[model samples]
Target: MASVQKISTCLWFDTEALEAAQFYTAIFKKASIGRITRYGKEGFEYHQKPEGSVMTVEFTLDGTPFLALNGGSIFKFSEAISFIIHCSDQDEVDYFWEKLTEEGDPAAQQCGWLKDKYGVSWQVIPVEMVDLLNDPDNEKSQKVMAAMLPMKKIDLATLKEVYVRG
Candidate 1:
């Protein structure tokens, strides 16, 4: 039996709820689309969306449940919130960086952070980064921070090299 999640993150989109859910599921392992809800006639007066249009899409990404809502253009995505992908190695980091940035804005790329085609922000970071940044040696941590500050897509190999050199 599947256990229920007490909380789930919700993503707001301007009529791309279903598409975004599908796209996210395709990218993450162990992910799948679940229930889909459409706007009903009862809420037409307030929502103003087409009654039959998608209202929400439930999905799981790497086992974490999420909801995508077609909430109209009144709200827009901002840099304040972002999903972080904790990559295990260079391969994982490279894979996410390439896939997520395929149709994304190149101008928005900075310090391992990117905005996808859907305008959703993501941070592709190596799991080892935490340890490197938390090192007891301040100089070592500073070196790692310097190497990371100028990178768009995180280079795990380069980070590792800097850590060793320090």
Candidate 2:
């Protein structure tokens, strides 16, 4: 079936399209793998992928459509592009952080951002953080920012408390 979403994210992997799809589907509660296409001899000159090798795998993560392309290792994921997961509460933030941070790069983590094993970066954030950071009171906003800046994974409850006390 065709994806109804007008725009979708495409992840480039070095012969890990299928593997990545499976990995992601297992993590997300509302996830599924869809169409998987294989390469053909037509593009052998450019892609150089075997005719029967996986070309792309389409999958969905919590309702968001994605495509995992079996692109070569010529391009690697960078921190410049990252996905933000908007969580509802501290539990959600902690859960996602623990799961995604497994085998992720420790040096890449900062301000609730983490890099997965595949070098893909993600921000597991509590929605309340956004609201508190953007609060009308500059003092509260500054306090929230200060409390969040040092945390690799945000402590939402503490941030809220900081906002209130400020």
Candidate 3:
């Protein structure tokens, strides 16, 4: 029997579906490409893409199922939607920030959010930040929020320092 994924996110790309899948799988642990579907002749009238070109790339990143579609350039990614990576510590945050932003636009980076080379937005944040932000003490949350606003990549230590000092 063929099992079905309960839900999966489909990422739209102009033609970097395969490339983006490979890039994401390489960066994340327990990630790998699953299947590659190419366009067929029958769809030429609508899709307009050459037959045999990549249509979709199915992949998993850290157990999260995703599909990268080589749709045309009619749409682009925006900061309105972003995937958040909760890191256990500073090192994890740094690693993801460095890798995701390696070829990404520096100007688009702000408040721990960055648009990767493929134009996908991601938020690399420390796991501790969640707890701090949700802390019942409004002062602590405000302090952490203040500390986080001015940074591109999150600084776990600095956030902790602010939370503790407050």
Candidate 4:
């Protein structure tokens, strides 16, 4: 069966399209690198990338297709957009938190969000957070939110503790 993805994400990198794709695919279990396009001498005046150098690399991460473009240093990633990974438990949360935060922006670690080494922001959220936030008891939800606000790597145990203490 042929699968089609009508919508996919495109990431712009200074010059690390291949490197970033490899990094992401290595971290995610179901990830893989696909087609790679190279630049030619025809566009040297504009792209400046060496002839035959990587221009774009198509990749799939955890089943989501993404395109990484070596678009030069014109555009940089910001915190406005982030990928969220809903972990089923603390172990899952910790695994992603440790992997994504490697040599990343330590200061950006807050409320389950962290910037990866490639300056890509990711949120390692516990699956229970959704239910906790949607809880009918506003007080419990508020407490959980408040506790999570000050955390760098969200502790599922702490959130669970707060909920049960109520």
Candidate 5:
């Protein structure tokens, strides 16, 4: 059989997989929910749920593949791996920063790292950040990094000011 071209990311939710998927799909464009299969009696788990309950809930976020599973709530999203959004300008950064940062969860870090409401990490970086970081002057780049360290979504103008000072 020919290999199918498909990509998927599995998300473990504490019995909130479907709700989370719906919330996410509604926020993003070109995204929608997929099939949600419930558990059957034969495969059901004794303690909580059936064996097949929410085996997989496939969906997309801005064309990116994703799957939400109704798994235990032992683990939640953290600051380890984050989504990097290459923003063209401040408006784009503000847009994503405002939307993803609902629910009063907003923390800023250096170099464009932020924690959203769902505890999911995000990086709203300006496209110019690459060039700034790659500057030949180590001191200049370091200075810019220092300024960025305390920021949530990077401000291009502020970064430029720091870069010029170096």
Candidate 6:
């Protein structure tokens, strides 16, 4: 028999995992709720708390697996790790930048990085960025990077201007 295969990305939240999951499902398409397992007697005994609390909640966003729990609100998501989104052109980059930054913190770069309202980090990068950065002249790439270091959504026009000036 062939084993079932599933790809998932786990997120750690400070007691807001469930709420974040709900928010993501609502914002994206092809999303829905899945299995929800409550805390059992064993867990309660171990944690010394009441039963029926959220032990785990599974859900799918755009067909992606996500698990949420009622873990105490202590830790939070930060910029140490982020999801990178590759875009085909400026339009795609702009669109994703607009949507992802709606309730997130924007960073300064040609490749975008933001922390969402739920504290999840994301990197929205244009597909052509590699070509621009891989120019034979390192000066061009350096200039582009420098110019992009202060922008939130990354203006492609500015990056191109920097590249041409080199």
Per-candidate TM vs. native? 0.94, 0.94, 0.96, 0.96, 0.80, 0.74
Q: What is the C-alpha lDDT profile of model 5 across 30-106, one tens digit per residue?
A: 78886777766763454267666665687878777778877677789877778787878888888777777777364
The best-first sequence of candidates by lDDT reads 2, 3, 4, 1, 5, 6
- Across 1-166, the per-residue lDDT of candidate 6 in tens digits comes to 9433466767765456567777777755578977777767886655554587666677776656778766666566667877776777888778767766776654423347776777677777776666777887888988888877777776777788878888
In candidate 6, which residue ranges exceed 4 Å CA deviation?
Answer: 1-7, 26-33, 47-53, 59-64, 106-111
For each candidate, the alpha-carbon lDDT, in order, equals 0.91, 0.93, 0.93, 0.92, 0.74, 0.70
Model 2 TM-score relative to the real fold: 0.94
Model 1: number of backbone collisions: 0
lDDT for residue 9 in candidate 1, whole number 0-100: 96
Error of 6 at 166 (Å): 3.3
User: Which pairs of residues collide in model 6?
Assistant: none
TM-score of 1: 0.94
Per-residue C-alpha lDDT of model 4 across residues 55-166, encoded as one tens digit per residue:
9999998889999999999999999999999899989999889888989999999999999999999999999987887799999988898888999998988888898775
**Runs with alpha carbons beyond 4 Å of true place in candidate 5:** 1-7, 50-55, 107-111
Lowest-scoring 10 consecutive residues by lDDT in candidate 6?
A: 103-112
lDDT for model 3: 0.93
Candidate 6 shows a clash count of 0
How would you encode candidate 3's per-residue C-alpha lDDT over 1-166 as one tens digit per residue? 9887888899999999999999999999889999899999997988999999999999998889999999999999988889999899999999999999989999999889999998889999888888998899999999999989999999888999999999
Give the winner by lDDT.
2
Candidate 4 — worst ten consecutive residues by lDDT sum? 157-166
How close to the true structure is residue 104 of candidate 5, measured as C-alpha lDDT? 30
Please list all clashing residue pairs in model 4, or write none if there are none: none
Residues 1-166 of candidate 1 have per-residue lDDT tens digits of: 8877998899999999999998888888889999999998997888999888999999999888999999999898988999999999889999989889989989889888999999999999889987898999999999999999999998878887999999
